[model samples]
Target: MEERLQAVTTPVLLESSAAGFSPWGSILRAIPEAAGDVPALLALAVEAGETWPRPGEGRTSLLFELLASVAAIDVAAARVFEPHLDAIAILSQAARTDTADQPAAAGSAGGTSWGVFAAEAPGARLNARPEGAAAVLDGAKPWCSLAAGLDRAVVTAHTDDGGRAAFAVDLRHPGVRCEEPAWVARGLREIPSGTVHFDHVPALPLGGTGWYHSRPGFAWGGMGVAACWLGGAVGAARDFRAGLLAGADAGREPDQVALAALGEVDRILAAAMQYLARTATHIDDGSLAAAGQSTWSEAQRVRGTVAAAVERVLQLVLSNRGPGPLAFDERYAKRMADLGLYVRQHHGARDDAQLGRLTLKGDCPW
Candidate 1:
């Protein structure tokens, strides 16, 4: 296991150098120009999944590598694809029910992508009820990514017993209705996130009510999102470095103030990376659970740290580069916008307060 981790980490470390960014850049460029191209992106994600880390073990290193790789090229694409990968990660730990009631594991219409629609917003009330030997899903699930493209989804709905449960729903079923895309934000606009309505759609419960949120893997999955955010931060920092190098090559000396800001950016990002590594190690050693620390608390801490680092990196780059990248560099601009939007998922001060409350319960492992 150590050998496998070293094999993965070595390449990531090697690629951290200026000369090594091209490999991942090439991979991103290889993606088709079509936005939200599920079939194309899914193919890439499936290829990446071949090397996905095993279940119930420490996957932080591999997941961080993946998110960083994909996000460096296109964070919007990462937003669209990560959920599918995360759904698979969640399914690995899910309580399996009768196989007779399970949907076929194959992709929908031969496409390889999947999605998770578990956000329980007040607008859509997806309900699950027992129908004979099976269960049926009804109502809408908002923030459903890859809705029109994916063949299946792990949807959360209110069960008849008034508790939340996760169900594997086949999007190909007649009762599953995908509303037209409504997202207009520039960031993650390429992702086909919209409302999916289930009209008595046949469902297979993956786990019992409340089990989806209770699993340790659930918190691990949240940490995966933070990893992606850190990757985006890296991408942004890389762009800043490239700009500085390009100026130097042209006999232009960087401003002293700008250089200082860049130094600070480096410190911020480096600290976040180190924190991520430590957190991953903790998860792997089982020290977090052993210490009676909730995975949710750890995830929140990591997310908060990464989100702040990304924000600082973005601010410093813009202040130093003076909007040149945002105005002239398409890739940099997209990464900036996408990361800004993605990190908003972190919930800022509210999450920090939650972490504070959780910490006060006992000795802080952090």
Candidate 2:
């Protein structure tokens, strides 16, 4: 596994750097060949834990690097097309039964944490709407990581039929447009997470009738997003460490504190990664209810951990540097902001309610 990660790291890194702040094209081209290695990225994420950021400036670096590899391999096609079909079939089949628990695996979808994270492309929820489908969409996806210049985007949309469905839309459709947003975000800025507009555009359906959220892949996708966020947090932690330890005269006391904090962060990330892996496996084994219940809680836990770690490191750095970090350093400031915003995606409180319903009420509502 180490050998595999090392072998691919250079190619992805070179491509990411050359591609610069707008490397979606390279990512798209790389996907078909590198899709199989996604699990490797997850393993790396788990191994790096929260300390991965010590080596880099923030989580965006590693996040984009991993995504670059995924795009290099083209996993999205399989994730969206094939698994979507399977998920729909399972959901439809399960719906026919008198009991909702007949086969809890109705929502399984392939693709590791990478696919899951990409699913949360900002405005995904909005794009997959009836109005968004029919009308001209003028809004932008603040951080659409792999969206720019892609051949196709499998986005969620509400169909004319009044049901939520994932649709495969051509990025170059006459009505479609992609541009970087003019606003500033805390991290992941290189993602081309700009705006995509559809002027009464044409699109193809991704799954069957009303099978969007009902499918199991949606939940799996959510878990995947949480995993990626965890990876970024780890990267940020690493960066913090490297910065603190770079100077020969750096104080040992702060290093000791950072190291201890890193250990706690590692524990939290490890638990989150395990939860994600177990959740994916449970879905595969026909245990959707168990997977869903656990996923909600895990997502929240991961976010809480990441937010806490980032904040802690930020505070420590501020105390040590005495306001140097606030001098508009894009990497540090943006990262802090991004991590803070990204944690909200974990659905922590919402997941708490979901877990309560699944565990205490003993029911799988979906």
Candidate 3:
């Protein structure tokens, strides 16, 4: 296992540090130092265009590997990179499912960082109405990350038919306006998710109504996010191991409690990794949706499982390693904090409740 990926990225990026490499090698290596530097991170992201596989391409594991590698390096960088890659996957999916009139080609252009702004907020809704061969967007779309920084995004809006559809938009349009985020979060403070307002902004339709959520790729893309969560936990575990190694280097042997914590963390991470790997295989083989299972349910399971591992790993690493690292080690501190908040994308128990309901409807994996 390599130090960076523990066998996830081998045969993809490099066999070893001394083996052959690609441009992605330097970009992945530089992400750690670029934490808290959003522009630098976005620059690195643009430099590595379309570097990941679209979901369900039979190489979905490689896609997960790239996402995990980025999160393993820096969670904040993953915050910027994951959605960019996800947007690409979504656009590619549109090309496959609905290509007659889609301008999704714009999303595939090089040197562009794209976002998928599908989150809805109270009192904010974007509506798209057809105007001749084009569509016009008007209203507010909330929770748009990097709205002002990114060159373009795939924005979902209520179509004239009373259903939601995804559209590609150039963020640089004159009718587009981004509101102040009033940012206050410590984690991902560099990447503020503000609301973007559009007034007569022209949009290129990407997919049919509700295709954004209806596609199996939706679930696969979500599991990719969980892979990022897995990587963040890997980062946390590395901190614990680094602490133990430093103690041993100073002739201070690790106590039983510290060793036990490390053991438990390894167990949790190993299980999480295997689960993600299995799910990736199912996705590639077209079995993720088998046995009357919903892809949404399986993706939720991935998120919930990985989120639990992240929570426990953070606890073990914090309790065993003590406060000295959090107080003194800036990089380590940021890693822990960023992972803490990013895993909340899992939706915690609410997701569990939804999964339970799904299970009630005969969607249980077991």
Candidate 4:
């Protein structure tokens, strides 16, 4: 497992360092202003979408590679890219569903970009009512990333039968309105995440009630997000390593303490990669199903592990390097903030409690 993990991640790191393969450089060049422009970031995402993993192309491998590459460059940019990839996956599944009357016009005219707005919060009621041939979505959906920028969205709303349903919404419609006062945070400001009000906006329902949540791929997608977190951790590790190397070159050799901290970072990251590789293989081989293990359980475990690993990496880097990276280096500062914000997407205590329940029930395979 260790060998396999190293094999998958090492090459990606080496290739990223090679000439003519600067994903981060390309992102900076494309969006030079970094003005938190949604449309511009979406455009950059669309252009780079081709480089992402395609269907049936070892999604696990590509996911790890992408997280490592993009996270190293800019985790906020990685945040943008992660949703695009997930939207593609969700839309593809929607396309395959028997409920899809016509083809899902995802990447059609007007350069449509997609986002998943499934975060459920009270006071923001996004309910779906069947009206003749289409579903009418009314009320507001909150925590919507790239709300203004996304041309289309896969939204989760309450159905008429008191069940949850997923729908494809066209944000360009007249009834749809994206609210202002986007997320105010230290990092990931580039993601224009806010509330979007739907005044009877027409939508296309995907699959039947509960299909979106019940699908195996749903858990797979969650693990993909974990991959992004792991990648961001790797990026942080790289910054620390670079700083140490520079210090060494300047005749300030890192003592045994600094060396030990670096070693610990490597150990944590290596363990994370090994876990990811094993999980990806299990997902690919349908091992979870065979073991009667729920994908949700597996996803939670992987997410929890990766999130803890990233936090540890950040703490160690700060302890060893002090506030220089965060204060002086703009890119490093952004990476740290972006990673801290992004990883919080995982519910901390609530998720841990759920995982404990799964373990008690003997549902966790690992």
Best by lDDT: 3
Per-model TM against the reference: 0.87, 0.53, 0.90, 0.87
Error of 3 at 290 (Å): 3.1
lDDT of 4 at 181: 51
Pairs in clash, predicted candidate 1: none
Superior candidate under lDDT, 3 versus 4: 3
TM-score comparison, 1 vs 3, better candidate: 3
Clashing pairs in 3: none
| Candidate 4 residue-wise lDDT, 11-83, digit = tens | 2332234443444335534442442555666777665654666322355654555655656556776677677
Local accuracy by lDDT, each model: 0.73, 0.42, 0.79, 0.75
Give the top-scoring candidate (TM-score): 3
Q: How well does model 1 score by local distance difference test?
A: 0.73
Instruction: Kindly state the number of residue pairs that clash in model 4.
Output: 0
Q: Candidate 4, which segments miss by more than 4 Å at Cα? A: 1-38, 54-57, 96-110
Off by over 4 Å in 3: 1-24, 96-110
RMSD of each: 5.3, 12.6, 4.0, 5.4
Off by over 4 Å in 1: 1-36, 95-111
lDDT of 4 at 312: 97
Ordered by TM-score, highest first, the candidates read 3, 1, 4, 2
Per-candidate count of clashing residue pairs (backbone under 3 Å):
0, 28, 0, 0
